[model samples]
Target: MSWFKQGLCFLPVFLVIWSSSTFIVTYLIALFRHDVDIIFPYISDTGANPPESCIFGLMTFISACAGTATIYARYKYVEKLSEDPKVVNPRLNKTAFLFGMLSCLGMCIVATFQETTVTVIHDIGALLFFVTGVLYIILQSVLSHRAYPFGSSMFVCRVRSGVAILAFLAFFPTVICAFFVTQTTLHRDKGDTDYPYHIASAVCEWIVAFSFICFFLTYIDDFKIFTLRVRVECKE
Candidate 1:
């Protein structure tokens, strides 16, 4: 029982829950501190706020750690399940796992440098994080489709694939638009924060975020099997 409990702490689910909770709390605090417009401001703005900077800084570090653990756990979990008879035909792609790990590293880089303090470094991190992140999602979606071809999970895998593509579609174009809009605004008036296109970009970014998050839900079905293994081992 103790071993089961201990092992549960290392699951991807645990890490994701921890990271998500930290982010939610940090965001709420930042929202309260700057209660102007929550939906329109980019996610980075919450972390960049003066009052919540320190807390969100720590939150990013925690997220980096959790991201690392989550990717590793997810790889191991899926790899193991691929060998099961229930799987249609398993193909374990180490390349996908490697790319996923790189995404986590990108996340760490983003967390280490604040956007407000170091714009260039932060932009690079964000670039790596999102580009590689969406790549990982697409690759994993392919891997999942291969892993779960005809089971109940197969449908979820397809859904994940769709969501991943949606995230990519929503992210890249909006990113270009946002960059162009911000640049145009800066050139026009340094003091103006009234760029309507910026808010549009923020909204699209949130859409991308939601889609990416849903893409990860494909693994939720595996949690039961993993947790069951823990309980059985503990029982034995």
Candidate 2:
């Protein structure tokens, strides 16, 4: 394989690094500015202010674009892998692609609208991202398992399954804890009875976010074997 073909693997690697960096940089900036408590802060809280918010918006937008590219590539990869074509249903892949893009749209919304400033829109965006993102992965995991010993390995299927399972498990706590806590508990009084829920929500949110990241990391190896190209044809 050419070096160009080899470089394809970097796409997923970039997504992982860039996404994690966005969270870390925003978290550090929030910490330095004392925008949030030193203990586990909501990922949005880190980027709810001026400087970090700016970086957060830009970085996450790029992350969404990268995520879109990753899903499309995987969609094509599976399409090519199908021997009977029915062995892997095109509808399933298309559905996964749709959900994946919707998740990216959610991420874009989350990026463009600041949580503190536009709570409702931001929360809606977040809902789109998390719910659809998990659905996307779960669908992809099923596809991977179905493709096993052909387009994918048993190991890859297992890993994707594990990550999808973790994300699914963590998602409920993240949402449930957030549901129980009020703004007063999250931002104002740590002494409130709901404070523990606030912390648990933040912790679970981080796990879900990183689980999403880890899920994509599995793609790096698979992406290594193929090169993506665009073809244009004319009928004369």
Q: Evaluate residue 145 in candidate 1 and report its C-alpha lDDT on the 0 to 100 scale.
A: 74
User: Ten consecutive residues with minimal summed lDDT in candidate 2?
Assistant: 182-191
Query: For candidate 2, lDDT tens digit of each residue in 1-236?
Result: 35325847878988999999999999999889888888888898889989999999999999999998888898888887765676788888899999999999999999999988889999999989999999999999999988777766898899999999999998999899999887632254667888898889889899999999999989988888887887999999
- Give the TM-scores of the predictions, in the order they appear: 0.76, 0.94
**Runs in model 1 with CA error above 4 Å?**
1-10, 81-92, 149-152, 183-194, 227-236
Error of 1 at 198 (Å): 0.8
Q: Which candidate wins on lDDT?
A: 2
Candidate 1's displacement at residue 44, Å, is 0.8
TM-score of 2: 0.94
Scored by Cα lDDT, where does model 1 land?
Answer: 0.64
Model 1 has how many clashing residue pairs?
A: 0
